[model samples]
Target: MTDATAIDTTGYLALVRRKRLYGTLLLAVFAALMASGFYVADDRNAGGFFDGLHRIFDFPAEIFSEAFQNWRNLPGLFLKFIPSLIETLNIAAVSTLFGALLAMAMALLSTRGLALWPRLTPLFRRMMDVMRAVPEIVIALVLIFLLGGGPVPAMIAIAFHTTGALGKLFSEVAENADTKPVEGLASVGGNWVQRMWFGVLPQVAPNWSSYALLRFEINIRASAILGFVGSGGIGYDLKTALQWGQGKYDQVVAIFALLFLTIMIVDHFSDRARARLVKGGRRA
Candidate 1:
């Protein structure tokens, strides 16, 4: 027994040493690859990375200098852009609402043990993977070309990406749900809709709401950028301000302030709501 125990201990130490050696080698290889890639990219650049590094703050300095000199213009610009700001928020809100609703349906349809058609689960999962894989900006650009640029196209773009993102998250949450309730409902002759509505939804609603809130915050930023590509929101206004160069820097600052304030407000409320939802915590 003593001999066998000694052999086992020796083998365990050898295995640990082998794993550590492999891990170190892997880390070294990864670092080398990253260093090589950086050098390759820098060589390919028209202006080298280190060469342009010092000038990076030039544009920010110009913008701030002009914006500060024209500080009094900020208030008017803020009031002027409020309507466009609302439009941007509208795009985000509509997209999040539609996307979350579709995500809930797709999540239920794709989740194993809860799917209405288990055989089609792979198909739905692949569909979501594709959806999530494509960037929202790519979709927005395509739709803008086809639809001639508006909030509608931006809304569709954000919603499309949101569906895939939220569907994946919602499905993950639904997968861990209590199977007992689902089983009990099905045993009572409940249809697929009934079983999911009564069993799965209740179990996952808090988590789902938290995810949706987070997505809504992200969509606001996306929609703002989409507007820059001619989607008719505050982003479009910002683009116009940028095109005007020196004279419009104050407008640019105004738009930035609005976007910053809006994101901060949304993030604050969403954090509180998620805390309350996921933990039933206090308002703070």
Candidate 2:
């Protein structure tokens, strides 16, 4: 019995050491992979990291210097770009509204037990996956080529991406919902729409609204980027100003300030709104 106990202890210690050694080897391999990837990326880059590190602030310095020299024009520049800024905001808002509505329908259709057609749930899920996988830029570029440059293309592109993203999140939330309400409604001969509208929507509305608001924030940035690549909004103006170089640096500064302020405002409001939504949801 003493010898058996000794053998068991020795085996246990060996197993533990083997596991530790394997874990260490895995970590070492991961580190090596990361190091190699960074080296490869650096090699392929047009400018080396260390080479550009010091000059990183050169552009910002130039913009600030020019803006300071022409500080009086900042307000005028802001007003000039206000129309473009509105276009950007409109694109984001319209896309979010349409996308959230579409996502709500898709979410209900894809969710188990809530689905009107359970067999087609997989189909709707795959459709959302495909929509999500296709980046906003790709759709924007394609639509731009086909329809010409405008906010319409950007709006559609962002909406498509938002639908897929929100659909998945909304469906996940629906899955956790209490089916008792739905069951009770159905017992009273409620149709699918009635069951969902009267039952699921109330439970999921706050979370859905929160997600939509967050998507609105992301869509705003995406719309601006799309505008730069296509045409329309402050991004296009920024791109144009950038092309003019030193002489138009003031305009560039103004654009940056506007973009920064807009983002800050949106982020602040969205944060507060989300907090309120979560608190309200918990209370309900």
Alpha-carbon TM-score of each model against the true structure: 0.92, 0.93
For model 1 the local lDDT of residue 240 reads 95
Best candidate per TM-score, number?
2
lDDT of 1 by residue, 1-284 (tens): 99999999999999999999999999999999999999999999999999899999998888888989999988998999999999999999999999999999999999999999999999999999999988888988998899887799999999999999999999999999999998999999999999999999988999999999999999999999989988989999999999999888988888999999999999999999998999967456
Deviation from native of the Cα of residue 192 in model 1, angstroms: 2.2
lDDT of 1: 0.94
Candidate 2 ranges beyond 4 A from true positions: 1-16, 281-284
Let me know the TM-score candidate 1 reaches against the reference structure.
Answer: 0.92
Report the lDDT tens digits of candidate 2 across residue range 1-284: 99999999999999999999999999999999999999999999999989999999999999999999999999999999999999999999999999999999999999999999999999999999999899999999999899999899999999999999999999999999999999999999999999999999999999899999999999899988888996589899999999999889999999999999999999999999999996884455
lDDT leader: 2
Q: Note the residue pairs that clash in candidate 1.
A: none
